[model samples]
Target: MKPRRKSVPVRVGNVVIGGAAEIVVQSMTKADTRDVKATLNEIARLKDANCRIVRVAVPTREAAVAMVEIKKASPLPIIADIHYDAPLALMALEAGVDGLRLNPGNIKDPEKVKEITRRAKEREVPIRIGVNAGSLPGRPKEGAGVRPPTEEVVAAMVNAALGHIHILESLDFNLIKVSMKASDPPTMIAANRAIADQISYPLHLGVTEAGPPRTGAVKSAVGIGVLLEEGIGDTIRVSLAGDSVDEVEVAYGIVNALAEKLTGPNLIACPMCGRLEIDMLPMVAEVEKALKKIKRPINVSVMGCVVNGPGEGQHADIGIAGGKKEDEQKLAS
Candidate 1:
């Protein structure tokens, strides 16, 4: 991987983002934030799945009030996701949330943003200027095509982030992170690259509303993996519409696939072809299950045929290949 983008480090609870810290993996809880029990339960599962940071949506007054209890019980650092309502952000900071995510799209008042920044600065809590393509600050320009030029979209996202960054920086409050997410990968990649060129604040990467697990993982992998390979992102989240734990798993998968710093065992399996000589699917599944207990990074390959087995599995730390017969299998060392 290319050297990571140089970013000012921001601490969220115990986890440090940017500056020489490992690419952090994070996910948002899907449960209603008002249901403290359910939210806590989801966080426990996310922690088990190796999520380093967790974001909880504080959309309602009750939810904002519940932040106190959830933050108290959450094992991972809790970041309150705020939109529209500035008081909700205040409520979260007062409840001792580790961090805050303010959507510039909906919460347009500069005075309110400054108020939250003052309180967050006093508490030393970091805030993420989370800009989403779907919720940009203004309506599309007149006489625009079906899709605006990529440059226009990219500029919009970056400018939105910079606007928020300006508000926080004005108060000498530099505990900041930024995210420019879009449901589409191209826009997300372009926006992040643009912002990365202009700012030193840590960036949280994701392809927002990236559909179900299968498709979302692919979209996130493409968008996040491309940036990570270029060393453009400081942290990442895979926004799958499924279980929150799957988001953590997919986030790690994207990181592991692109970067050398793996969080868990990396499983390499070949797509079964007609040349296959053994039932490698079951074996791959079994190996994946066994690798879950491992905490360290290792490459383990399971190939289904001899044609590419020797060549493909040769570099892996451990590998298994099917032989001519079902009972015969060879281990590559």
Candidate 2:
């Protein structure tokens, strides 16, 4: 892996992001934020999945108010996502949320942004300038008329984020993180690369609206993994349409696959081939199910056939080599 990008450190509750801190795994609660009980339950599940930071949508005044209870109950640091409504941002801060995710494109009024920044600074709460391709402010008619869609999107995301950062900076507030996301992996990558070149703030990576588990995981892996490999991302969220717990699982998978952070079992299994003398499919599945319960970092290998199985098994913390003998299997450590 390449050296990680250098970024200014910002604290969210007890978790520190950027600087020397390990890349954080973040997820949003899927339950209605107004239903404090339901939101707390979902956050508990995410916390179990090793989610270090959690964001909850604050779409209504009731939901913003409920953040007080949710913040009290959540194990992970809570970030309130506010869009279009600066007042909700203030309410979330007043509710004592650990952080805020504000979409500059949606909330464009400078005065309102200044007020939010002032309140956030007074409370020492960090804010994330989250810019999404789908919600970019419309292009100004005074600007150039034509550009490639990718260029236009990337430029818009970076500009919107910088604009918000400037607003906060003008208020002498600097505890900030930024995320420029798009469903398209290439667009997300391009926008982040552009922003990384210009800013020192920690970046939160994600592929927004990335579909269900299988496809969303792949998209997030490509977009987020690419940035992480290049040392560009400081934190990540795997945005999926399914349960938020799945998002945490996938986010960890991406981070782990990069060898950036190892949270659980690292399984190495062989794809069955004609050389196999015994059925190892069921055994591998069973081993996987059991490994999930073990939190300590360990590598487990399940290989079929004797050709390379013994050597591979010997290298793992615990492993099984099938077909070592006609009726016996070899287990090694």
Candidate 3:
């Protein structure tokens, strides 16, 4: 079994983050935060999709005000994503948010961040410091207005996070989460690694602007997946620029992709060779589709014929071998 990295445990409402807790899965709401009914409806959809935590943008006073009702109606804890306006962050906190997120570097004004941290510490709300390649102070300076290399992106994020942490630390606040998101896979991967080396605060892993579902899901899985494999991240977001429910589904997949070490089921299949007689493609797809409904911790195998079938895949907790149907029934059973 792989070891999880050492990280501080940060709680978001009742959910425990970092430090051996199952990686928390989160997705942002697509509905405008000002639209209480619509945002509530969308978060219901995300919750059904298994989103562990939900973040909504608090870009306006109306949204910050709406957060009171939204938080009232929400079944899960709400994390308000605030940028540029520390007042909005302050208002949302008063509106009864469970957690807060802000890019302190972008907040620009020092006094506001200090006050935000003071209020947050009072409420016991954990803060997530989001640092993006597009918003980093030195992103342009580091790469001459082009995309920065991995180390620079990491440096800027850690610097930004540490900057915020310093203010919060001075305010005697300790609960925090941090993320450094990039659209590129390698930069995202490298940035997490670099930050992980320097900070023990829980890390939220994500690749922002990762396109449409199929393409974005692949990129998110690879980047977040690789980081999680290294035991580097605590919470994860699949930032698909689409339905937030899909983001939740992809987030769960990324976290549990390697979870077969203890929980859930894993499927293994063999590609058919010359021994292929039956059209097994549809059969494999059918079984895989059905297996999604199985929450049990078991291993399932679907293999081709005698050549590539049974020998290697027999270790599955359960299995099926494809061949002449009548002869193979007992073997698969």
Candidate 4:
């Protein structure tokens, strides 16, 4: 990968994003934020899965109030996801959240944003200006050819982000991060590439509203992976529609695949052919399950037959190869 783009480091709790920091992995809670107990439980699970930061939706006053308790017990830094309502963002800041994610498309009142920014500056909290393709300011209603072209969409995303970024900068508040997300991979990639060239603020990358795990992972990998390969992302959230833990795992996988810094165990398995002498599927599954408990970056390989097992897995940290008999497999480390 090329050298990472220079950025001003923004601290989210104990974790530092950008400015030579390793790529951070973030996820949002699926549970309702008003359910403090349930939200805390989900955060705990996310931490166990190696999520570095967690975002909770604060759509109502009750959810904003719950941030106080959630932030107190969360193992990961807490980010309140706020949209449309600016007061809830203020409530979350007062409740002492480490960070806030505000959608500039919906919350367009400059005075309202300035008020929230002033409070954030006082508390030294970072605000992520999240721009989504579906909610651009003054976006046209759904109709034939009503949706803007790809170039228009990309420009709008970047413009929205820059507008909010300028707002924060006007207050001399540099604790800022930005994200321009679209459900389509090409649009998402183009918008981020455009904004990355224009700003030094740390970027939070994602493909918004990506479908279920199976297809969502692929979409996220394509969009996020392309940006990371160009050294343009600071933090990433894989927006899979399934369990949030899967989102964390996918984010780490993308980081591990591109950057020199690795977050979790890496697994390598070979495709079985007619020469295969062992049940490779079950063996690969078993090794994958065991690898999850490991936090460090280690490569493990599982091979089906001796024909090319040793050669293929020679560089792995650990290698397992099958002999003609199931009992004759050999392990090398």
Best by TM-score: 4
Per-model root-mean-square deviation over C-alphas: 2.0, 3.3, 3.1, 1.8
What TM-score would each prediction reach against the true structure? 0.94, 0.92, 0.86, 0.95
**Tens digit of per-residue lDDT, candidate 4, span 250-323:** 99888888867566798878888898888789989999999988999887878888776786567677887777
The runs of at least 3 residues in candidate 4 whose Cα sits more than 4 Å from the true structure, single-residue gaps closed, are 140-148, 327-333
Which lDDT tens digits does candidate 2 get at residues 58-132?
A: 999999889999999889899999998889999999999999998877999999999999999999999999998
Q: What is the TM-score (0 to 1) of candidate 1?
A: 0.94
lDDT tens digits, residue span 112-206, model 1: 99999999999999999999988986635435435666788788888888999999999999999999999889989999988898999999999
lDDT of 1: 0.89
lDDT values for all models:
0.89, 0.88, 0.81, 0.90
> Which window of 10 residues has the lowest lDDT sum in candidate 3?
324-333
- Candidate 3's C-alpha lDDT? 0.81
Residue 138, candidate 4: how far off, in angstroms?
3.1
Off by over 4 Å in 1: 141-146, 310-314, 327-333
> Which scores better on TM-score, 3 or 4?
4
